[model samples]
Target: MIEPRLIDTGTARLRVMVEGAGPLVLMIHGYPEGWYSWRHQFAPLVAAGYTAAALDVRGYGGSDRPDAIEFYDMAAMVADVIGVADALQPDAPVILVGHDWGAPIVWYSALTHPARVAAVAGLSVPFTGVPTRPLGDIFRRAFTDRGRFFYQEWFRAPGPAEEEAERDVRGYLRRLYYAISGDAPPGSWPEKPAGATLLDGLVDPDPFPAWLTDGDLDHMVAELERSGFRGPLNRYRNHERDYAWAQAWQGQRIGQPALFIAGTRDPAAFGFGAYSDPLTVMRPHVPLVEGHMLDGCGHWTQEERPAEINRLLLDWLARPPLRL
Candidate 1:
């Protein structure tokens, strides 16, 4: 791995880990995860002759964390992506790959600044185009209003979620990670009654899955402990704002080569009854696209199945649409 550094993106300074040197491939990680989440991909990406850079998404790890909730909005996040690309390779566009919240971040980066992003790919979450309404509202109707627990709804508030997670960072990470992973037993993430905290129904599996090592958990725990859950949880607080800002491109489509990957067992991949298939849901928004669903794979796509994810990514990068 190459040395990590912080790049000033005007709005904030983002910590980035970079490796190799060729056509740039910028990776963005999802909630409760830092650039370290993409640790499995850098070596393979470098070996395949592509410069790989993964960033902390402005809030987690070594990146600057803004106090205001609005600072973590979609527009600001997109700017960070462009800023990183410009800092790394000002002369050419870069490829983007994201997981979970990172998925939407990269999708919007390509949509809002097509000139800077040559192609885009997402894991665990598919591009659904510009939002007509906030997902929080949808979750409210589906889960909250019906007296069910929705993690995002719990995260929508400011202090409570942070306190709960921060009180026991390792325990929180352990339970959350295990609960959503494919390794968890069936019915691990069952719907809880309303008023339940994010950690209420989660399980802390003993002898944690082979995919996530003790070293990995220690690294993640250390970062979250230093940064606190405020910035990471703040990402969920901007759903309403994100929906409103996305209106500028209400009808816009990401007219770039795209790829998507997800675990078959991943709850986020099911689209919450909005769509049954990710490929079908993403096709309209991303015309030139390809997708793969790893059997029994969970939210941690690349980490859970690094070999398969690497093969899919390298194969996609080698395709005709994106020869770089």
Candidate 2:
């Protein structure tokens, strides 16, 4: 059984779903998602003899949604993770696991407070070489090769995208979720088909993955509809802020036992160039690193292939930490 708890994380009140008993494990979800995104791994990790908790990061689910973009800054988000650890397991450090946007937070947490994380695993998103360039340079690097870079900028644009998304949130969310999950036409990754903007009007009778049922979509729709798109979209608006903070830690390496799990078909795998040279970029910082590419899967690795994700988590947890 999963038990829900609210922890005061100073910046916001974060709601978490926790279960089991052993070394603490903290799970972070990505944008347009909540702790329910980790529903597949919760009980499995618990049965494997680890106390696991999946957090609804600030601004989503039951967590307080602050109104300011600065409030969603990397430092504040990382602090929420640290605060959760402090409130739940004051004496022991946690095994950090994150998906999508959550992966970035894990990377930051491990970098900022290495001692607080026992072992770290990132799903769908891998640790790119840290921010060593200005916001414009980062944008250019991200999009330099073909249309690889426009999507990130699209999210940051303060115009129709956000407005349309907020107009009919339920439909907009369904399309966004589908787009990332590989429901679009072939070769949709490197570049979207001609005239296919990311935030274009919702397709009639949206094509969501079969793996995600109406109940799952309903959960996402309800949360996003009530909260609107601002809270989540604001996460993208802080790219400059994140870049500035990450620049402070340039050349800093995260020395934790790290693992990255990617869906072979996930756009982000190739979109961010994470799969291109993961060993060179990730292994340098996290010396003890492991990578898994799940076949026939998309961005939503946990939901698309729950059993595989569960096995990966169990195996990673079994491995001893670097200094333990």
CA lDDT of each prediction against the hidden true structure: 0.91, 0.77
Q: TM-scores, in order shown?
A: 0.98, 0.89
Candidate of highest lDDT: 1
lDDT by residue (tens digit), candidate 2, 186-266: 444445532345665435244456778889878877876766666677788887788888887888888878889887668
Give stretches of model 2 more than 4 Å off: 140-149, 182-185, 189-197, 201-207, 271-275, 322-324
Can you give the lDDT of residue 324 in candidate 1?
63
Error of 1 at 194 (Å): 1.4
Which 10-residue window in model 2 sums to the lowest lDDT? Answer: 187-196
Q: What digit string (tens of lDDT, one per residue) describes model 1 on residues 100-185?
A: 99999999999999999999999999998787889888889988899988888899889999999999999998899889899998
Best by TM-score: 1
Give the 10-residue window scoring lowest on summed lDDT in candidate 1: 267-276
